[model samples]
Target: MIKRIFAALLCAMAAACLSGCAEQTPPPEEHTGTRIALSMASRDQFLVTVETSVLEHAAKNQVDCTVWDAGNDYVVQMQHVKDAREQGYDALIVNEVSPSLTRGILREAEDMPVVFVNREPEMSALTVGKNAYVGSDDSEPGRFQAAWLNDYAEEKGLEHLNIVYLTGIEGQASTIARRESLMDHLKVDHDFVYDSTAQFDRAKAQVQVGMLIEAGRSFDAIVAQNDEMAIGAAMAMQAAGKELCPILGIDGTIAGCQGIRDGMLSFTVRQPGDEQGRAAVDAALALIAGESLDTVSGVTLGEDELSLMIPYEPVDAENVEEYIS
Candidate 1:
C-alpha cells in the first residue's frame, strides 16, 4: 500500500511537470527599435511607385519603417517633419511637398539623419547631415520628350506645331528642370506655351484640360510633367474630341506603359519610381552605418548614379505592348 501511494504521487508530479512545460511559451522576438520615416509629396502614381519600392527594400533590411503622405501641402509637410523628428525616428526620407519648404524644418534634425530621395532643395545642411539623394535626371527626360515630339511631328508632316505644357506643383525642382530641358531642346522657332499648373491634382487636371480644349486652344501636343497629369489630359482631350494629339508624360509608371500600348498617349520616359524608394532606404542605412555612399552629384537612382545623363526609354507603339503588358 505504501509503494502504491508513493508511485501515485510520482505520477501526479511528473504529469504536472509535463503540463507546465507544455504551457510554457517562447521568448518575445527582439525588435531593434530602429525606425525610419518616409514623407511623400502626394498619393499620385509617381510617388506611389517610389513608396512601394522603398518599402520592399526596408523589409529586406529589417528596418521598422513608417510612411506618411503630406497631401501636397507645405505646411502639413513641415508638421510631418516636426512630428517625425519629435517621435524619435532613427532617420527621415523626405520627398518634400515643395522643394523649398522642408529645408528649414530639416535644421531641427540636428544629428538625427535626414535623406532626400526625389526632390533636391539647396539645404546648406544637406552635406553636413551626411545625407545622400537618389533620383534619375528629370531634365534629360524633358529634353528627350521635346526632341521626340519634334521628330514625330515632322514625320507626320505637321508644321507650325504648338505645344501645351501641363506643369506640376509650381516650385518642384523636377518641374523647373524638366520644363527648361524641354524648352532648350525643342524647336525654339515654334511655340511652346504653358497651359496651366495642375498642382498634381488629377481631377483638376482633367477639368482644366477639358476646359482648355473646349476653349478651342490650338495645340499639337499636350506635355504633362508626370504620368498622372498625362492621363488626365488624355481623358480631357478624348472627351473634347481632341484625342488625336500626341500626349507625352514623364514617370514611366505601369499605367503610363499601358497608356502607350493602348494608343492613349504618344510616349513616356520610363523613370523607375521604385528604384528611388529602394535607394532612399539603402542610402539611409549606409548613412547610419558610417559607410561610404557613392558621390551621386546630379541625381541618384539607388546607391549609384545609374545612367544619370538621360537614361529614359521612349515607350512607343512598337515596344509599349511587350514592355508594359
Candidate 2:
C-alpha cells in the first residue's frame, strides 16, 4: 500500500510540472485590430514633426501604428515595405527616399494600400483606388515666396534685382517645381547671380553662401527652397558683416519663424507638416476601412484623384509670432 502511495505521489508531481509548463508557454499572437506601418525617408526635423502628428492621431483613433526610418535609402525602404507586409500590417504610409523609386516600393507593397507623404511621387506610380499621395503643393510655396519678394522689390524701388538662389536636393521634384515656379511668378526682373544645390543642408548652404560672399558676388536677395538653407545663408551674411536682405525660405519651421522674428529670415511659406501627417493617417485609416480618399477632411484631391494637397500658408515678420510657438 505504501509503495502504491509513493507511485501516485510521483505521478501527481509530474502532472503539476506539466501543468506549470503549459501555463508558461506563450499563446500564438492573436491578430488583433488594425495595424499600420509608417516608413519615413529620414528623421529630419520637418519629418519628425509629421511623425509625431501621425502617432498622436493614430493613438487617438485606437489604431496600432509603427514607424521605421529608412535613413534616406531606397533599399532600406523597400526592405521595410517587405517587413510590413510579412508582419501583417494592414496598411503602409511611406515618405519615399527617392520619388523615382515609388514603383519599386509599390511592387514590394503588393496589394497593400500605401499612402505616400511629403515627397511627391511620379503620377504614373499612383492609383486612385490603391495608393495615394498626401502633401502640400510644391509649386505653391514658390509662388508664395515670389509674391512676397515681388512686393519687397517694389517697396525697395528696385527695378531689377540680383538674386542668389539656393536649391534643395538636385533632381528632387520639390526642388525643380519650387525653383521654376519662383522664377515664373516673380514680377520683377531678376538675375540669379548665384545658383547652386545646397542639398537641403544648412552647413552646405552656409559654406556655399560664405564662398559667394568671399568672392564678392553681388546679390539683392536670397531665396532658398527650404528654411534650413535660408537660415544658413542668413548666417553667412551675418558673419560677413553684411546687412540682411530679403531672405526667403519655405516650410515655416520653428527656426524659420524665429528667424523672421529675429530679422534673420524675411519670410517663409508654411507647409503645415502637422496637417499633412494627420491627413495621411486619416487617409490610411479610411483606406483600411474600404472608404474613399475624399472622406478624409481638410484635403483636396488632385485632378488625377490620386493626390491630396494641403494648402500652404505664408509667414512673415508681421505675423511671425502666430507661427513661432
Candidate 3:
C-alpha cells in the first residue's frame, strides 16, 4: 500500500512538472507512513514560507513530519538534529543556523539520510551518496543584481555613483556569496557611501538607513542582500521624505515583488521558496528509500553531485506583476 501511494505521489509530481506549475501540486492523501523531521534555523519571514510549503507537501504525501525551530541558535539546531536521529526519524531536513555547524550536525545524524536546505554547507561536509543540499546557487542572485544595476547606471548616463549596500548577518554563507559576487560582477564605477550589516532584519535596516539619511549622506542607489532589508530601506527613505532611488534586492519575496510594482524596488532575484521546500521533502524521501537524488523531478543536481539547485529568476517592473500573487 505504501509503495503504491508513493508511486502515485511521484506521478502527481511529474504531472505538475509537465504542466509547468511554479509551485508543484502535492499528492492526495497520506498513507506512506514515512516520518521525517525538519530542523529549522529560525522562523524568519522567507524561511516561514519555506516551512509552510514543506508542511503542505508532507501532508499531501502522507509523511509524518515534525518541525523544530532553533530560534537562530546553532546549539539549539544541533540539539534538534540529535533529537531527530535518536527518535528514529526516517530522514532529516535541516536549515542550519550556521553553515559552519554542518559537520557537527552531520556527525549527530550518523548514518541517517540528511538534506540541507537554503543554507549552503561546505563541500567537504557533503558526501554525494550520503547527504545532499537543496537550494539556489547563492552566487547567481548576486550576479543578477549586479547586471541590473549596471544596466540601470548606463541608462541613467551615470559614469560613477555613490551606492548604499546592506548586508545580511555577518559571515553567513549567503551574505558572503551574494556580496562578493555582486562586487565581482558589477561593471559600474561606484563607491559604497553607506555600507553596513542589517542582519537581514527590516527594522534594523530601516534604523540604519534612517541614520544615514539623518547624517545627510548621499547615495544614488541601495542594494540589499535580501528583500526584507530592501523594503526597510524603502520605508526609511519614504519616512524622511527623500526621493527614492533604485533599490535592488535578492529574494523575490511577495513584498519585494509588490515593491517592484509600486516602484519602490528596481528589481529582485526571485528565489522560489515553494520549489525549494518541495524539493527538500522529495529529496529526503528519496534518500530514505535508497533512491538517487537525480530521480527527483523539477531540480537539477549541482556539479558536486551533493547539491540539488533551484534556478533563480530576475524580477523587475517588466515582470513583477507575474510574481505579485
Candidate 4:
C-alpha cells in the first residue's frame, strides 16, 4: 500500500512539471518583416496609380504585402477584412468601398490595426489605438479649384460667370466636401446653370454633358470633381459643336496632365497618389511595430499627429509639363 501511494505521488509531480513547462513555452515565431493585407475598394485609375506606388514602396521596405480587390462591393470588403484577420495579417490597409460601411469593417477587424487610405472612415470608427487614416484634406483640392477659377474669371473680365459642376460618386465624402468647398468660396456673382453626378466616370460625364447641351443649357465653364469628368465634358462639348470654355478638374492623373498640356483642361489638383501610397505603407508598418505616429518616416502627421495629409500640387498649363508623362 505504501509503494502504490508513493508511485501515485510521483506521477502527480511529473504531470504538474509538464504542465508548467508547456505554459512557459513561447508561441511560434511570427513571419518576418511586416505582413500587410492591402484591401482595395476598386480598380479605378487613381486607385491603380496608388496601388503601383504601394507595391513599389512595399518592395523597397521589404514588407510582405498581399492585395485583395474588393471590386467595389462592401460585402466583399468586409469578407476581405475577416479573411485577413483569420490569416494572421499583421495589419490592413483599406481604401474603403464606402465610408458609411466603415463600421462593419472595423467590427470585423477586432484587434487588428486598420490603416485607411484615400477614402476616410467615420471619426467614430477610428479607434485611437487600432486605426489611423492617411490622405489629403478633401476640401483643399476644392479650394485650389476655386482659387484658380476666381483668378481666371477675373482675367477673363466675366461679371457673372455661368458654371456647370460635374460631380463624382454621389455619396462619396470627397464628392460632398469638394462641392461644398467650391460653392462656399465661389464668387458671389456666379450662377450654377447645371449640376449633376457623373459618378467620376469619363463616359458618364460625357453622356450627361451631351444631354445638358441638347437641353440648351448655356454655361461659361465646367468644374468637374475629377479629371475624368472634366475630360468627358470637354469631349461632349466638342461633339456638340459648342465652343469649349475653361474646364477645371481635380486629380492630376497622367491623362489629366496631358489634357492640360493639350489645352483640353484649364487646370487640375495633383493629389500625390504615389507619395500617399508610400506614406500609407510606412504608417501601416509603424502601427504593426507598435511605433508612435511621430516615428513614421517621410509622412507629415496631422495636428492629432496620427493621420497624414499630403499637400496638393496644382497642375495647370504652366506646370502641366512636370506632371505629364
Which ranges in model 1 have alpha carbons more than 4 Å from their true place?
A: 1-32, 295-311
Tens digits of per-residue lDDT, candidate 2, 1-325, equal: 9999999999999999999998999986654488999999887667888999999998878789999999988789999999999999999999888888889888888989999999888879777788888998899989998998889888888899899999988777899999889988999998999999998889999999999999988899999999999999999999999999889999989989999999999989998999999999999988888888889899998788778899999999888888876
lDDT of each residue in 1-325, candidate 1, tens digit only: 9999999999999999988887796665676667899888777777787898888888877788999888877777787778888998888888877656655756766666778867765544466436666666778888888888888877887776787888887777888899899988887346765467987566777898888777877777888888888888899888877646888888778888888877888888887676667778877876787765653333333423321222556667777776665
Q: TM-score: which is higher, 2 or 3?
A: 3
Question: Quick one: ranking by lDDT, best first?
Answer: 3, 2, 4, 1
The residue-by-residue lDDT of candidate 4 on 1-325, one tens digit each, is: 9999999999999999999998899876555667888999988778898888888888787778899899888889999999999999999999988988788888899989988998877867687657788888899888998898889878878777888998988788889999899987887378888888988899999999999999988888899999999999999999999888989999999989988888889999998888888888888887878887677656687776567878788888987888875
Output the TM-score of candidate 2: 0.88
- Candidate 3 lDDT tens digits, 180-226: 89999999999999889999999999999999999999999999999
Off by over 4 Å in 4: 1-33
Name the lDDT value of residue 305 in candidate 3: 74
TM-score of each: 0.83, 0.88, 0.89, 0.87
| lDDT on C-alpha atoms for all candidate structures | 0.75, 0.90, 0.90, 0.86
Candidate closer to the true structure by TM-score (higher is better), 1 or 4: 4
lDDT: which is higher, 3 or 4?
A: 3
> Candidate 3: where is the Cα deviation over 4 Å?
1-30
The TM-score between candidate 3 and the true structure equals: 0.89
